[model samples]
Target: MIGQRRHFQVAHRPRNDDESILPLINIVFLLLIFFMVAGQLSAVDPFEVEPVESAVDGQPGPDEFMVIVGTEGRLAVNQDETDLEGMARLVAEHLQRHGDAARVRVKADGRAEAVEVVGILERLREAGVERIDLLTVPET
Candidate 1:
């Protein structure tokens, strides 16, 4: 009796299989909805570009000519690829044709540098474009 040894053991609870994954499912659905709603709803430009968004209600005029600036600063006037000088010449000719009703819409890539955009704007202004509208997507 004096040399007897005692052993001790600790009890552990088994994990329950009754845990529900409803919360996980809910999170997945919420993410799906967020993506669908937050995603871009605007029309794709001729070249791959993500334009800036605006809160204004008015849309770009249909009669106005469009000038697209690529991400790398490539210029396209009325869907015709050209340099800045060429674009200026073309826009000037168009302005003469439309007379006082001439309108120009500039759509530049969001990733384009500010300098590039400014240069394009300056060219348009030099071509006698009194008012140049910047194109943007509506903010949701």
Candidate 2:
């Protein structure tokens, strides 16, 4: 048989481009989803408001309501921009909704006036916010 006219043929299957790249595509999609979900974990401020420096570092609770105050007197509650009265109204509404268990945190720009910040705290107090925590960056 070897010396005679015996033909040996190897069967080869065509490669599918899509099948070769399936794992890569899956990994890309997984990475995309991971970043999308991770990006929304933290609340973003509406404007530029650098936190003041503090001697201690602290982490905010997930359920805490955030109030951002910019250097130009801009105010935002939970990333929604509002005026002082509007902020006060929102705080009151939040207090009514969450009652005494509501947690409030204020993140103010380092350059913001102390009087303005104090006034905001006073307004919050009037709005029935019993405890307010000020967010700050730890000194390096």
Candidate 3:
């Protein structure tokens, strides 16, 4: 009996490759869900814009319209890229649909040409946008 060989049994099976990464997949999915729920996702602009800094702060209204003017004279109306003519047409259409209460805000890049910015403002005003504001970030 002492010379007899003892048989050892394995208690658990070895994990598969997919099973090894299950915890990692779960963690990644949890992080993605957390950001989607906790983060405030807004419409992105067509191009990058660094708004000029100002000393004063302005309270934006709920019905405000956003107009983006990029450094290279690129224009966007509420995230939709368009030319000056298209912007005016869109602004006019928006006014007709939402009424004059919807104030327009021009977010021009700091390096944007002043003449172009002024021209855009002029075009917007001609489109019957009465209350147009220049959006500026608070100076640090």
Candidate 4:
């Protein structure tokens, strides 16, 4: 009887070429940092000019005009400062140009006096402005 010998070959795993992932990860991190550094945050509207509150919340129509009153009695129409008489004229012109449907929104500083706000409101009334709104920030 002859003795039989058998040999078996084991296959080794192929080497991975995945070292490129490290550079890709580094590039991704760098791009993430660049975007974060380049991104800009919009400036917040001044808190000193806190607006008056309203019971109703909804989108304003296009005919609406914004009037801002500061604590120092400064008056602004659509963010542009104007005198009392000028404001009246401006409001009148706007109403005349935009028609009777025009609305007015008053944003007054929290510390502003009632008289100042009332004066502006009166002027607006005289200008034929019917729909008036007092702007305010919701309590957080």
The models' CA-based lDDT, in order, is: 0.80, 0.89, 0.86, 0.76
Best prediction by lDDT: 2
Query: What stretches of model 2 exceed 4 Å from their correct place?
Result: 1-19
lDDT for each residue of candidate 2 in 1-140, tens digit (9 for 90 to 100): 66789778999889888899999999999999999999999876789888999999899877779898888788999888999888988888888899988779999999999999999988888788988999999998
TM-score of 1: 0.63
Alpha carbon lDDT at 61, candidate 4: 47
Candidate 2 vs candidate 4: the lDDT winner is 2
> Order of candidates by TM-score, top first?
2, 3, 1, 4
> Which model is ahead, 2 or 3, in terms of TM-score?
2
Residue 67, candidate 2: C-alpha displacement in angstroms: 1.4
Superior candidate under lDDT, 1 versus 3 = 3
lDDT of 3 by residue, 1-140 (tens): 79999899978978679988999999999999989986755556789999999999986654568899998778998878988888878888889987958688999999999999999988887778888899999999
Specify the poorest-scoring 10-residue window by lDDT in model 4: 39-48
Q: Which of the predicted structures, 1 or 3, would earn the higher TM-score when compared with the native?
A: 3
lDDT of 2: 0.89
Candidate 1 pairs with clashing backbones: none
Alpha-carbon shift of residue 95 in model 3 (angstroms): 0.9
* Candidate with better TM-score, 1 vs 2: 2
Provide the lDDT at 89 for model 1.
84
Residue 135 of model 2, lDDT score:
96
Better model by TM-score: candidate 1 vs candidate 4: 1
